[model samples]
Target: MWHLAKAPDLADMEVMAHEMFALLPEGFRKLCEGLIIRVDDFPTDEVLEELQAETEFDLLGLFQGVGLPFQSGEVSGQMPNMIWLYRRPILDYWAEHDETLGHIVRHVLVHEIGHHFGLSDDDMEAIEAQVTDEAAEMPLGAPARSG
Candidate 1:
C-alpha cells in the first residue's frame, strides 16, 4: 500500500481544496461567495517577484484582490477575488510536517481566505477548529466538485 501511494496532482489538490471549503462553517462559506480557488504547481515568476519571495517554495499560497473591508460598490471592472495554492510548495511542506494532506490544504485555504475577510490569525484558527469538528461529525464520502 505504501508503494501505491503517490503525491497528489493539481486536479487532485483542487478537488481537495473544494472539499475542504465545503466542510467550512456555512457562514464562513457564505462570506467566500464568488471567490476563486486555484491550484498550480508553483506561483508564477511575476507573483514571486511582486511578493519579493526569494524562492518559489517560499510562498505556499496567496490571496489577490481587495479584502472585504475595502470593497466598494462603485468600483467596477475589478477582478474577482482569487486564492492560489502552490502545489509543489504545499507538498513540500506536507513532507516536512506531521500533518495530513487534508489538514495542510485546509490550513492553507483558511489562511488565504482569511486574507479576503481581513481576519486575524486567531479568527482563522477558530474557523479551522470549527471545520475540523464539523468534518469529524460527518460521514466520509467523496465531495461533489464545484468551480
Candidate 2:
C-alpha cells in the first residue's frame, strides 16, 4: 500500500520545474543555461492580455524573452529567457487527466523551452519520452500546506 500526499503549491511546483530542467539531456540543458523558471497561481492580467488567453487555465506555461536562434551580436542587453508555469491551471489539468503531476510539469517545461529553441516534433517527443521515464522513478514530494 502506498500513501500519497497533498497537492503541490506554487513553491513546490517551482521546485519540480527546476528538477525537470536538470534532468533534461545535457545538450538540451546547455541551450537553456540562463533560462529562468517560475511558478505562479495564475497569469497576471497583463500577461493574459498579451498572450490572448481566453481564460486563466488556458495557459499552462509560457516562454518569454529572445530565443537562442534569434540572438545576434548586433543586439545587446536582451532579457534572459524565462519559463512560467501556472500552478492553479496545472493542478486543474492534473485533476482532469490520468497522468502524474510530475509528468504534466515536465511536459509543459519541455514544450515551452523546446518551441523557443525551434526544436522539431521528433526532438520534443524524444525529450518527453526521457523525462517521463525519469519522472516515474522520482518521488512527488509531500507539498507543504498552503496558507
Cα lDDT tens digits for candidate 2, 87-127: 99999999999987778888898899999889988889898
Local accuracy by lDDT, each model: 0.83, 0.82
RMSD of 2: 5.4
Tens digit per residue, CA lDDT, model 1, 1-147? 889888888987888877888887788888877899999999999999999999999998999888778887857888998989999999999999987888888889899989668799999999889765445233234753322
Candidate 2 matches the true fold with a TM-score of 0.86
Supply the global lDDT for candidate 2: 0.82
* Candidate 1 residue 98 C-alpha distance from true site, Å: 0.2
TM for every model, in the order presented, reads 0.89, 0.86
- Which candidate has the top score in lDDT? 1
